[model samples]
Target: MENSTQITIENIQYSLSDIEKDCWSRLVNGAVKSRSPFHTPAVATFGQKEISLRTVVLRKTIPETREIRFHTDVRSRKWAELLSNPAISALFYDASTRIQLRLNGLASLHQHNDITNDAWQKTTLSSRRCYLTLHSPSSFSDIPTSGLTEDIEQENLSFEESEIGLKNFGIVSIHVQSIDWLWLHHAGHRRAFFDYTDGKYQWMIP
Candidate 1:
């Protein structure tokens, strides 16, 4: 029943480094595996007006730099909020693994640049549809809407046609400053806090 790290009186099986590796492993999998629980995380932002939270798909993760990336429409509210306030936090949880990760970081926006260009090149025509909206996200409409024109909504765009969406597509990168990891188990629970700024971590009572 036990693997690399097991529930113990002291719960010292996983070292700080091991925990960090596991954290990134899950994140990487989340980015590539659509079924993974971590594939979509709650991204939160604190702006001048209010605290905004939204669930976004995990597009990429770079462990070396502790950076995470997600795609967003340049006109989305979250994109505007991040531009105004770089502070951000992403929360992830895997029920099957009984693990939770909370990441605090600063966000940077990329548009019409190599970063966004690469991302756009990898996006499918269907996935690029959101960026072709007639109105910016959150814009009040006469009726509830997805923001796309009726014809565009009913058909898929060609690769050439999808090019127009690139103007509205952008990449949101989060430079992780710290990570709070938690493992839940019936026998006991384990918690750890990692401070990337100082490269230090410590176990916490769970």
Candidate 2:
């Protein structure tokens, strides 16, 4: 028979297991490093020369190295800010789960090389199709009445073959210093902050 018992602590219902908490942390980290488009976060930044904010996918995460990766176009406005100041912040919110993660870190741009080549090699043809568009990302122009679309399937292009796009493709990495996680529960609220700078982590006042 399955165990059927109602238990609550401080009016909050949860399984009494530290493993779950540990697993959740690992899962969150995995999401931060996921390659899939669905796993990325919508990035935001303070305006300097201009407002620099856009959706960015999580390309890679190296725990040992303490780094996070994202891809963008070199011609984009965000790319300019990244060059001027590597400090950047990211915000993530999950409506279904009612959870939010705010992170601040230093950013770095990766140039085309063996490491970049490896990362580019994993992109799918459909994903690469996004790079085949016109180079100007946020340019202003008038479009003619006629429009055209290319048959991406017939391209038979490898990930590396998008040399032109790859040339413009910029990899932005963030070395996380701190991350604030907030969860809104029906019974109450939970908030925590993880600081990677020091060897230990302490709960922050929420």
Candidate 3:
């Protein structure tokens, strides 16, 4: 499908140049306020010969640092891929708003560090279950399931029980280098590019 480049919310309209900062504000707000699947953006990383893409829940967005963060199991292939090559791109599209954000960034992994510890402290035990899986993510299995052991299938677990999984939990922080924003409208499309590395922000033809 074709893309659009405009922002129309309520009765107000905003041009790229006038709303660059506002666009980021809205993006961060959407990540926090919206519960839609679009909140889980698809992040792509380079493999040896191809690009690997996987959907990840947005954990945090820091506009001050131009960074985005997500959690993952250290054993996941994407973790290994990022360790090998930190270059990555994340794509987010809000169907209701018809806005798409393409973020290019460098990914850094945090494990067994203060950064991961702080994030872990804020993580709920329910969200920590996936890290308790008996097998590493994507491991070959004859059955189709979440890979969690039968004993750990319960929704709630004691703090001690959840501690085991903490060892595998890791945080990935993406330092955004650039953002390409596109908004679609029946009247016309609006597109803009923001390059943080070079301190550039400008509109472009869709």
**Which candidate gets the maximum TM-score versus the true structure?**
1
lDDT of 2 by residue, 1-206 (tens): 11222223335554323322432454356455464332667776554755566777776666556666777767777877778877788776666666677777888788687767776677666666665656456666587411113444467665456655666666788888876766676866656666767644444445
Q: Residue pairs in steric clash, candidate 3? A: 4-183, 5-183, 5-189, 5-190, 6-183, 6-190
Q: What order do candidates take by TM-score, descending?
A: 1, 3, 2
Clashes per model (N, Cα, C within 3 A): 0, 0, 6
Tens-place lDDT per residue, model 1, 1-206, is 34544433234566667788889999999999999999999999987678889999999999988999999999988888888889999999988878999999999999999999988999988898899998888889888788888767876557898789999999999999999999898877889899989988877888
Weakest 10 consecutive residues, lDDT, candidate 3?
Answer: 1-10
- Give lDDT: candidate 3, residue 188: 78
lDDT of 2: 0.62
Per-residue lDDT of candidate 3, residues 136-174 (tens digit): 998998878888766677665687779888899999999
**Candidate 3 lDDT score at position 25:** 74
**Who is ahead in lDDT, 1 or 2?**
1
- Candidate 2 lDDT at 178 equals 72
TM-score of each: 0.92, 0.72, 0.89
lDDT of each: 0.88, 0.62, 0.83
Indicate the TM-score of model 3.
0.89
Superposed Cα deviation of residue 74, candidate 1 (Å): 0.9
